[model samples]
Target chain A: DTAVSQTPKYLVTQMGNDKSIKCEQNLGHDTMYWYKQDSKKFLKIMFSYNNKELIINETVPNRFSPKSPDKAHLNLHINSLELGDSAVYFCASSQRSAAEAFFGQGTRLTVV
Target chain B: QQPVQSPQAVILREGEDAVINCSSSKALYSVHWYRQKHGEAPVFLMILLKGGEQKGHEKISASFNEKKQQSSLYLTASQLSYSGTYFCGTVRQAGTALIFGKGTTLSVSS
Candidate 1:
């Protein structure tokens, strides 16, 4: 079984549209995070939540939103997507703030 | 600021040794190392806390220098299966989220 899984591994959309990617982890971790990987393979942290509470939110655009209904799920929603939003979005989790992180397969989002 | 990873890529023959370096401009409290193969999720290798402890798994080892906000990963007697991209994640004590480096690509040859 996959330790962490994300839906719609591939997300293709147009500019000015809205989209959402779902992520779930069964590793029983309390902390979850969202990251965006640019074309140059530079990974940037967008948000992090612990036990459904927002812990850290990077300097991301307001168009991006993260929701954690519970400890096992953390989903990302993007509104009015732009061409710059076309990148790989990764969902990750760890036992706590300083533990080793477990990453999901990643969602490749394409915006035209 | 983003952490800097040196030797963007490396090619090592089996049984060869290599070192990958990661440094940050800001102070750091901990550093994490992970390996990601192409088309695969990154797998955690080791973590170096604030202390000067060196952790290792098999022939792979890592050291963290809190003073200089730097860390080094040593791959000894590298094997073909060791081919992958290594990433270093750093977190300052005042911050909870980790800032990752671009990554180091390692190719182990026969």
Candidate 2:
């Protein structure tokens, strides 16, 4: 079974369109995170949720919002997406915030 | 803060050795290593805690130096499967998420 799974492995939309990517983990972990990998392959953390509570919110733009309905799911909603938002988004889960994490396949978002 | 990685890229022949270094500006509580292929998710290699411990995985090993705030990943007898981008993630303190480095690209060719 896939430990961490995110829906919509590929997303292509207009520049101003809004989209959402859903993430779920069956690892029974307490912490989950969202990371963005740019063209340069630099992985940057965007948000962190622990036990359905917002923990780490990086310097991401306001258009990006993360919601955790329960401990097992964390979803990312992007509003007014721009061309610069084109990147690979990955969802991960860990027993603790600092422990080893398991990552999803990644969602490739291309904003035209 | 983001950790700095040295030798942005490395190319080695089969059975060769390579070293990838990661340094942090702040005090690091633990360091994590991961490897990612061309178009795949990053796989966890190992994690080193503050006590400056050394961990090994197959032909790959890593060392942590808390005082220097640095970690080194050593690849020995490199194989074709070892060709991938290696990333080092660091945690400054407890209850914090990992902050990854710029990453080091390693290419192993016959």
Candidate 3:
């Protein structure tokens, strides 16, 4: 079984459209995170949830919201997407906040 | 704060050795190493917690200097499979999110 998994490996949408990416971890980890990798390959943390509680929220735009319905599931929703939103979004989980993280295959988002 | 990585990129041949360094200005409680191949997720390499401990692998090793808040990843006997971008994630405390470095690109060819 995949330790971490994300749906919609590839997504292409028009500008102003809203979309969502779902993430799940079967490792029974307590902490989950969402990271965005730009074209330059710079990985930036967007949000993090610990035990279904919000713990870290970077300077991300309001259009991006993260929902953690349960400890094993975290989902990202983007509203009115822009061209800048085109990037690879990754979902990761760790046993604890500071432990090594396992990342999902990634969801490639393209805004045209 | 984000950690600074040295040698933005490196090219090495099989059997050659390379070293990638990661340093932070603030005090760190632990350092995590990961390697990401093109179009793939980042894979964990190792983790070095406080106490300035050193961990070794069959061909890769890493050292941590808590006082200086620095860590170095040593790759010996480089293999083509080692070609990827190496990232170092640092945590200031146990419950904080891991902050990653810009990453160092490594290319190992036979």
Candidate 4:
């Protein structure tokens, strides 16, 4: 079984459209994160939830909202996607107080 | 804040060795190393905590220097499978999110 999994491995949407990506982890971890990797491969943390509570939220736009229904799931919803929104999004999970994290395969989002 | 990685790219022949360094401007509580291949997720390689600590897994090893706020990943006996982009993540404090570096690309060829 995959430890961390996200739906819609590939997504292509038109500008001004709204889309969502779902993520789930069975590692029984306390923390789950969303990271965005650009074409240059620079990984940046977007949001993080610990035990279903928002912990760290970077300087992302309000159009991006993260909802964690439970400890095992973290979903990202983007509103009015822009051309610059095209990038690969990754879901990651890690145990509390641990330094290492496990990442999902990634969801490639392309906005026209 | 993102950590800085030296030698943005490197190429080595099989059996050769290479070292990738990561430095942080802020004090770091821990440093983690991960490798990602094309079209694949980043795989955890190792983590180092505390000053003067060294850890290794397989032929890959890493060292942490708290004083300089730096970490170095040593890839010994390079293999073709080792060709990938290596990233260093820094933890400023416990229970915080990881801040990753720009990444160092390593290509090992025969």
Candidate 5:
């Protein structure tokens, strides 16, 4: 079974559009995180949820929001997507006791 | 904060040794190392926690210097398959999010 999976491996939409990316993990993890990898290959954490509680919220714009429906799923929704938002979005999960994270294949969202 | 990685790119021959370093401005509780191939997601290498920290799964070795706010990954007897982009992630405290470096690209030639 897949440890972690993300929907719409590739997404393309125009600016000002709204889009959502869904993620689910088979592993019984208590924490889930959202990371953005820029074109330069630099990765940064956007938001983190542990046991459905917000733990970390970086300097991400208000246009981006993350929601955890349950411990196994975390979804990211972007309002009025901008060109700068075009990057690979990765959803990761890990146990509260473990420092290592298991990442999804990644969703490449291209704002055209 | 973002960790800084030195030697943006490196070329090494098989059986040789190479070192990848990661430094943070803030004190760290642990450091995580991972390698990513050209088009694949990163694979975990090892984790170094605080002082007296050193871990390795294979010929790859890593050390964390809490006081110095730095960590280094050493690959001894490098193999051809050891070629990939190495990244260092720093965790300032327990349950904190990881801040990654720009990544160091290593190319091991035959």
Candidate 6:
């Protein structure tokens, strides 16, 4: 079974369009995170949810919102996407905070 | 804060070895190593706790220096399959998020 999975592995959308990426993990983990990898391959943490509670929220734009419906699912919604939003988004889950994380296949978002 | 990685990229031939370093400004509780291939998810390699312990995984090993808040990943007898981008993730304290470095690209040729 896939430990962590993200839907819409590849997403190409136009500017000002809104989209959402769904993520789910079956690793029975309590902590989940969303990371963004830019063209430079710099992985930056965007948000984190522990047991469905927000724990870490980076300085991301207001247009980007993360919703965790349960401990197993965390989805990212982007509003009025910009060119800068084009990158690979990865969903990860860990047994606990600061522990080793298991990553998903990643969703590549392309904005034109 | 994000850790700084040295030697942004490296090229090696089969049987050669290389080392990548990661340094953090704040005191670290632990350091994790991951390797990612082109268009693939990052795979966890190993983790080094704050005790300055060294951990090994097959031909790959890592050392952590608690005093300096630094960690180094060592790859020995590199194989073509070892070619990937190495990333170092650090945790400042318990129950905190893991911050990652920019990653070092390692290209191993036959």
For this target, which candidate reaches the highest lDDT against the unseen true structure?
2
TM-score of 1: 0.94
| Cα lDDT tens digits for candidate 4, A9-111 | 9999999999999999999999999999999999999998888888788999999999988889999999999999999999999996455799999999999
TM-score of chain A of 5: 0.97
Tell me the spans in candidate 5 whose CA falls farther than 4 Å from its real position. none
Highest DockQ: which candidate? 2
Question: Candidate 5: which pairs clash?
Answer: none
Residue B46 in candidate 3, Cα distance off native in Å: 0.4
Poorly placed runs, candidate 4 (over 4 Å): none
List the pairs of residues colliding in candidate 4. none
Instruction: List model 5 lDDT by residue over A32-54, tens digit each.
Output: 98989888888888998899898
Positional deviation of B71 in candidate 6, in angstroms? Answer: 0.3
Rank list by DockQ: 2, 3, 6, 4, 1, 5
In order, candidate lDDTs are 0.89, 0.96, 0.95, 0.93, 0.89, 0.95
Report RMSD for candidate 6: 0.7
lDDT of 4 at B76: 96
* Candidate 1 lDDT over residue span B47-90, tens digit each: 99987789999999999887887899999999999999999988
DockQ of each: 0.67, 0.87, 0.84, 0.76, 0.60, 0.82
Superposition TM-score, candidate 2 onto the true structure: 0.99
Per-model TM values vs. the true structure: 0.94, 0.99, 0.99, 0.98, 0.96, 0.99
State fnat for each of the candidate structures.
0.69, 0.84, 0.73, 0.71, 0.43, 0.76
What docking class should model 5 receive? medium
lDDT of each residue in A59-111, candidate 6, tens digit only = 99999999998889999999999999999999999998667899999999999
**Per-residue lDDT of model 4, residues B1-110, tens digit only:** 88999999999999999999999999989999999999999999998986769999999999999999999999999999999999999988888888899999999989
Per-residue alpha-carbon lDDT of model 3 for B19-71, expressed as tens digits?
99999999999999999999999999999999999998779999999999999
